[model samples]
Target: MTARPPLWRDLRVIRAAAQVAALVAVGLLLYVLWFNLTNNLRRLGITTGFDFLDLPSGVNVADNPISPGAPLRRTLLVGIKNTFALVVVGIPLLTVIGVLVGVARLSTNWLVAKAAAIYVETLRNIPPLLVIFFVFFAVILQLPPPRTPLVFGGLVVSNLRITVPWVETGPGADLYGWALVGGLLVAGGVAWWRTRVYERTGRPHHRVLWAISILGVVAVAGWFLLDGPIRPSLPVVDGQRVSGGFSGLGAYYAMLSALVLYTASHVAEIVRGSILAVPKGQTEAALALALSPFQRLRHVILPQAMRIAIPPIISQYLNYTKNTSLGIAVGYAEITLIVFQAIGNGRPAPQSILLLMGAYLVFSLTISALVNYLNRRLRYVTN
Candidate 1:
């Protein structure tokens, strides 16, 4: 180190000095912003602390269990649950639709390819809000009203709500549920055991087959032993009232359908591009190896394409999660809707807005982390 340069002249020391200065500047800026915000809010006669969260939230979310007098904190959590319901259901449905459409886009049949292209182009160009509006007003609202609802067996449809047959737990339900959990644990243990046996003895291990067989045996035996712990709850409508089974609100379906279709359009394009990005030589090699087309696509194309596709798809997921706020239009009470409702009900606007931002940040970060973990697992590693 050339006999220790002057502290200020040393590169490491200079970097450290600059970092400290930058950190100090950032800290001061944050302090100033917070001070200004608090002062402004104080002047406006708003409580700046979070004690308001413990106060009664005199608001009720439609189709949700949150009562008007519930604590604000509990109300917000219930809103989060409603939002997460959409995420869980919509994401899987959209993914399946996207993958099918993407694969169809690459089909050799003219009709199939053209149809997929038209779907992708038409939906992708239109704004997502328009899609949501169309689904809500034109599709969902256009359904026959509650009194003259359409029905097919256990399925009941109307502009007000859609009801479907769902499982109702009976006396042995809790025990049956625990039994299933135990089966899952046994399956997992068996799989690990099989893996270790394969590693030690270098033998073929049909671990998945064994695990599924074990689980299936447990499920069937438990069902009979527990004397049918679950039964179907079929819904029926009487005039404007609907009861029995699980009733889904028209607004929920409208928002879920619109968001899934819109996001799937973008996902379709991502998937198509990723699949096309796979080397043509890989396909040719697959053909040379005498693999069937389905096998070739399944085993060779998808794995590679998925690795390329996931990074961009991560952003799409984050976008979709944020876009769930649009459910407000259809009156599906998600977190954003609830937060706004709180603000309208004399809640502090600034703090409520901050909480809304934090809610979205948590959702987005969680999705990003999960997808990034998958991407990492799928990536190729080398020495």
Candidate 2:
């Protein structure tokens, strides 16, 4: 090879130098901006630290009263918890709805496909904020007031709040939780073994049935071992104070319902697209095997479609997470609401906003990481 050119003329050297220069410039710009912000705040006699977390937040959220001398930290945690609750409940509900509707859109039956199309078109076209508002003011707020709350099948429903029986964990809760995880792992192992056995001996696997039975047995055994560490908590409303079960404010329901339906529409479209992306030959091959439609879709199509669906689905999860911030509109105390409230109550805006951003960052990264892990596992590999 010829002698290398000088750093000024060499392509690799120029590329490296440009990247380093850009990074240094960006860093210097950020530092200058930070210094300017600090200088302006100091001149205006404003503080910028998280010391505000300890300051007393005088506001009472929902029916949950904070003592006047109580630190803002507790309130912040509650807000974060509310945000977490929305995501935990909403994702599963939306996913089931999305998959059902998506698959429905591809049905051979005219009515089913048309109906799914209508649903996807209607919701996805409407602004999510509009959906939330309609759900809040027109739907949830239209329910009977708390004083005349409906009681049916252990559920309490009202314009003020919706209360449902949720599990209350006891002293053995942590250990019992681990036991549940163990049960799942054991169930998965059994399913895998069943698949292996079927492959070896050409027997009917029925792995789903086996997994469910194994999991249920383990769960029941764990429950007995822990002396029922998780108990049903039914709402015991004694005037203004409600105890026992989980209670969500009407705003919470509105937020959750609106987001779930709105997001499901988009997810349905994604699923529909992913299914279409699968090779037509694959479906034809399944048909050639004399497989019924359900068998063809279930055993052949979905597995491949899901692999395509997962990568884009991760984006929907992230979108749903960030969209929870919109909860602030309807008086739901998600992190965004509480942070803004803290700012309104004389907390440092910059620091509180930073914390708010960080919360969303963590939530998005966590969801992305989990979905990415699943994506990696499901990724197709060929020898």
Per-model CA lDDT versus the true structure: 0.91, 0.90
Predicted candidate 1 versus true structure: per-residue lDDT over 104-217, tens digit per residue: 999999999999999999989998889999999999999999889998988899988999999888999999999999999999999999999999998987899989999999
Predicted structure 1, TM vs. truth = 0.93
RMSD from true fold, candidate 1: 2.2
lDDT of model 2 at residue 202?
A: 100
Off by over 4 Å in 1: 1-9, 189-209
Q: Count the backbone clashes (under 3 Å) in each candidate.
A: 0, 0
Position 146, candidate 2: lDDT: 81
Off by over 4 Å in 2: 63-68, 166-237, 240-244
Most accurate candidate by TM-score: 1
Residue pairs of candidate 2 with colliding backbone atoms: none
